[model samples]
Target: MSIDRVVEQIRTSVFSYKKLADRLAERPSERVRAMIYLKEIAAEYNLGTIEKFKNLLSFTLVKLYDDIDFSLPTGLDLERIVKENNVVFVPNHQSHADYLILSYVLFDRFKFIPLIAGGINLNIFPIGDLFRKSGCFFIRRSFNNNILYKLTLEAYISHLLSSGHAIEFFYEGGRSRSGRLLPPKYGMFQILIETHSQLDPAVRRPLLFIPISIVHEIVPEQGALTRELEGL
Candidate 1:
């Protein structure tokens, strides 16, 4: 599928006014304000510019960082497994560049990309919109006891798996800015684990969990991390 088509699909898959409104209706008292907030956000999100954003972001990131590379095996038979099973990529989070690097690799090697979950706060301006079109579905961190929100997210994830789409999420939720390997937060990973039973019985034997780690000899964000840690 073309990037524009896929991006449009991803955009609607997450932000549907009808669906969100219906979900918000579950909590009658909160519907009015929630709808107002949703309306504003819905306007803020745009799919038209996203296609250009993806092409530019990938090209720009790849060109700017010459030292980036991966540790994936040279002759591992991942393609056959990828065809037979729904794979879940569990990668260590280290830098903001991680997703850009991974997307670049997938784009170059496989010619296909996977949709993943991200926070809605990243749905803001230029960079955030760039990320959205790059196959990310934005979500809120705190669900606020909103059952509708939780169920919607779970349903969306389930749909992606049942359709044989490869899934990915940071095993630690986000980067360990302190420069430490974090204890697995199990945030987005829990969705797959929880809904394992709901997957198609015939092809659900092994949900391939590909554990990948991308590293850099000199982290470009080291200084920024240190300053943030020091409460700058």
Candidate 2:
């Protein structure tokens, strides 16, 4: 059998098993069902369980993007970066393909990198749902005053980092409405610091911050971003 056939079979079997398990487990909500399915697959694969689902998702993403002509930078030591340290990948946001591109570069080359994404109304769709199941937690975009929500997010992020998962996120809050790199938002940084502070000194791990810059010579949304930035 071809590799493509094998991969498709795996995907089908996993999804089918997940559906059956969700039904048996009495998970009534779609969101919850999806979450359960992810956890089950993660466990079955022995890839670190649900707690490490983000890494598994990153692996899947890299495979998906490899079908394209995506390639990683040369002479960069990906293994040492991903395997040896708790990494926080901060990339400049540009295209909608940022997630797939980065995931492909990291996983296809280095192996595993877990990514986090903002959960907003706009992210609710088939692709969004796929990301969430693959291990992306949603963050509320406008929860400016929601202290409880902020704390919960912080805690979850801390938990993941402390457990040795490599994290990837866009530091520029949202995608650049302009072609230029927007000033970095300190929310994610602040949360990382706070989480670091709370870690028991004896059990703490070194966190490595990696900044990735992606430059597209010709942006597809240049016109749209220019218009949006002008209005701002």
- Report lDDT per candidate: 0.63, 0.58
Error of 1 at 169 (Å): 0.3
At residue 177, candidate 2 shows an lDDT of 41
Q: Which runs in model 1 stand beyond 4 Å of their true positions?
A: 1-59, 202-205
- Candidate 2: how many backbone clashes? 1
Kindly list the per-residue Cα lDDT of model 2 for residues 25-137, writing each as its tens digit. Answer: 46444434433323322211123333354456567655544444544478767677666777788888876666656664555556664655544543456655455544455
> Among these predicted structures, which one has the highest lDDT?
1
lDDT of 1: 0.63
Q: How many residue pairs collide in each prediction? A: 0, 1
lDDT of 1 by residue, 1-232 (tens): 3434543454454434344546655666754554333322321223454445556766787666765565558887666767777788887877777776786677557765666666677777876656655666677777748665565566566657666777778788777755567788665777677665666576464677899877666566777998988899
